[model samples]
Target: MPHCLMCTRYNRKCPGPIDAPLLFVDTSSYPSGKKPRAKKPSPPATSFDVARRFEDGRGIHGSGNLSEEMAMVWSVDISPRHVWGDAFFQNLVAFFCAEGRHVLGAVRRTPSWLHALPRMAATPPPSAARNSSVVRANEALGLALRATSAAFSSLETRSTSLLHHAYGLYGDSLRSQGRVLQERGDKGENLYMVMTSIMLSMFESVVATTGEGFASHNIACAKMIDKALEQASTGPAKGRGNNPGAGGPSPMIVNVFFHVRIQLCFVYLTTSDDRIRNDPIMDRVLLEACGWEKRRLPLNMQIITPFARLMKLQSHADYEQLAMPPTEFEHEKADFVKAKEEVDELCADICDSCPRSCYNIAYPPFSTFPKIKLNVFGFFSCQQYCTSARDGQFHHARYVSDLSRAKFVVAALL
Candidate 1:
């Protein structure tokens, strides 16, 4: 199968900071037994930009404006202000915001909307009682954010030293998180802790090719998440945690949690792991927590939900088929066929819609952008405006990877 060359998601090679030229390979042009002509070599794509080191102006693949690129990736077209600090901390902050270079353009990947990452990274926790959960929480979260930023830098720069630094910080974060868990014991049901684990998993995903790191982090946090959700849903406040004076984490926490939950469930739905293949508990929590099954869900979610449900059901049926009676096995097999047909028809109707809804408006040749959007998603021309073409094709490529992931899921089910 022909996979995209511009993205780095799920271990696809990141084409650094270069643009996928308007040139597309058409194998059909060659007639049967016709000799193909060798084409003239073109100029090298300046390693396209992903993240940049301020002051030094060093980039991994290359460097370019991130603000406008961020705007284009978003559905609402929102952008962040240009980061101005020259300090290391400030660079980390800037990189955190720009890590979309690594994430490409998946909006839910980092949850950086409205400066969430900058705020989360820049705000140093205040001094509290020694060994207090507050102090440990601050250290773990603060360091995790820093490590995540470093991981982005490592990818952009392809620097082993930077990756080592990121790993060291990652170690610190783990230790701090362990302290929190140890100090609190069973009472360590913390939203911050969960968030920390997510970031750590993200760091591992970026730096490590094997999925083991990501899986480990998530599995460790699973019981904590389950317990927290149970408390939140059943607590007197309903949808709030049980701590008094703490009312609960903000609605923002819950909302981001909901999206990430769905995204991760979607992530594992296609995983090779048998223990978590379309986890039924996670599927149930996702539906109950966010209502992604409703008709009003986003276009992507609407198309994906049915298959998610189907895949979960199929995985279950496949696992139990040996013990199941012939009648029950046959019934599920019929249901699978019907579900697959319904999903195929549903996608066929909106097949044109995802392509029709968006297009790329190329910037001038002499402008800041190095390239223009011609994001070819196999069959359609949806622009993945992660950053300017002149900068890097991170967003465009990441979006492609996301599509590939979707294909993986659908393909498995079909």
Candidate 2:
């Protein structure tokens, strides 16, 4: 029901249902034994060392103009001052162009194209299974999908916020253009529609990718579910397989979990899925295991509260809402800016939890928080009494205390 812009119309494109089953596979378990030994350290190599081997052949593999560019660039000893400064001047000139103005805001939004995010999967897929490659590929794919999903979630929020900001900027620009502020019909609406449309398109792309990922995970999990069921049924056990349903809710649990995953995946399949947007309700199962901590007072429900808030703000931005009165607009603008700050914090948190796979696809060191030592295990205070000779002071203290207590009790009794 918590729909994104693209998910409003493109409901059928959700891959979550198909990807639902894959979450159940116990990929963690295989060849159970003592932990594997750490590999010995290898010698370090530099970029120059590696680059030397591929120097001549570099960037020449493409079909056409690649060779020409390579030949031209390498043929001349281009001065740094000439090439680098010229390139900068070229960009400056291009920025002022009519066509460049259109994409400048969008391009400027992401200055760095690829970033390295910290990945969760430290271990490779299990080796003992015959379907090791399939399993490994699936795991890798799932990680990628999850990372994408997280990014989409983050992007959708920012996109919405941007739309809102653009609308405000359009209104301000209109005021400068000698347009009456009180008039209902303004160019802001048209500009907003165009910007909102782009945001919607982005959401559409995200949904398609998410759906594909979910479907892949689901197909793999379905096979696993079937296999798991067969093993439970045909395999010899102490008790008969009379009650197949009582597989400790193993297969069913997995089925349900991934099924929910699919539902969530597909839920955002349409921007108009009012179920997610208008009075959206979350199942208890989802609200709990979705990796968020429960709070006491304000009764915060989401696993990642800041991220959830960011998404909520994005949702508002994504949808078509009425233009507020100037006074209300100023208040909403402040709220929107606050949401943007919160979004930055949320993005930072997501980068922390799931590193390097963020917008830049490269891990930013500042994204990670400084580590503080937490005593997960509480401390215990032990009162120790050392005896001078075998059982001297300690024994005497104990005996005297007992004697005093006993005497007091006797006197009270008397």
Candidate 3:
């Protein structure tokens, strides 16, 4: 007799009689040397049935209600085979709910699409029942989240299987996103679509070995940000926006604009792609939308602006070098160096402004470290940049040296 599929795949010894019912195949009913007539197919096992099996210790014991149990089947820590299953997607959503704040850092506080994902995934919009566009977009977001989480897990475990699975999910997410955009046109500018774009960008940024894929994802994200900002500026029709309570653009949209701008700046800096560099008009629009001119910005933004400016200068220089004569390259190089110096000065100013208490909290005895350690992490990150710059080499070699020094600093501090 053939081995039971589950037992074969999971490498567990078949518990003969017990496995027969679960497999839904009755060998005794089939007579030897004769094919048995077809019987009515059994009804599919429901979540309640799965829950009972789990409760009886015949399957993995996953805590929670039936829906949760169904979702649990995909958790990497629980059942690795279901990496692309709906259950795994649910687990990914749960992971984001619990740890997304830490994983995403300061942006977590903002009311962005990511913040809305759990609710959207669990309850879904009532309109989704009637709207195919909304349904596809929502599924895309879920797939993107699951893919990104799987990619992160793959990084930690160095698991080839999980990595491949993540790519599969990412591909499906993109397909669904494309379908929604093709079908709905302007209606595709919803929060779920934006969230899908951002999540895919993050996944590409992490798992992409080459700059090409990462750069593509960044450009796509930039376009999405522009569309979203334009919609917010024009103002949606009465009762048309995602959140009725939001008088203006939601904090989430504003945060996403800033995040994408910062990310694009980094991409331009690394790739020297003029097309990917910040547009002055769009920057102005974002600044106006976020009310940056009228109010103090976060500490991180304050620090990031100078670096972004430096990169913008570098991007212009790159373009000028490509277009101008060799003799003119010297002038652009001089300009870049000057901008670099200003950035260095800004970094110094930010470091000097770092609170003494931040140093105290980051100091020693890992057990006593405060829960809010970003201050300390930020200080170290700034110091790392300074150390890397002092050597006058901004290439791969400098990165290595800076990382080594930063690790040592962290070790000593902890």
Report clashes for each candidate as comma-separated counts. Answer: 10, 29, 1
TM-score of 3: 0.52
Q: How do the residues 1-414 of candidate 2 rate in per-residue lDDT, one tens digit apiece?
A: 333323445443444544444323333345763455689998764443332222222322324464654765534332222332243234422321122123211111121111111121223334416543333333332233222333343354554433333333323333422221133223222212221222222223444454443333333333333334344445453113333233322433333333333333333323344544332232222222222123220111122232233233334432233222334334334434443343344344445664342234222132221121000000000011111112221233432222223222211111
lDDT of each: 0.50, 0.30, 0.55
Give the Å shift of residue 2 in candidate 3.
33
The C-alpha stretches of model 2 lying farther than 4 A from their native spots are 1-120, 125-135, 138-142, 153-206, 209-224, 237-242, 248-414
- lDDT-wise, the better of 2 and 3 is 3
The best candidate in terms of lDDT = 3
Pairwise lDDT winner, candidates 1 and 2 = 1
Highest TM-score: which candidate?
3
Is candidate 2 or 3 superior in TM-score? 3
Give lDDT tens digits, candidate 3, residues 7-118: 6766766778644545434344466845577899999776545533432336654465667557655642334334433443444444433332443232333323455655
Count backbone clashes in candidate 1.
Answer: 10
After superposition of all CA atoms, the RMSD between model 1 and the true structure is 27.5
* Best-to-worst ranking by lDDT: 3, 1, 2
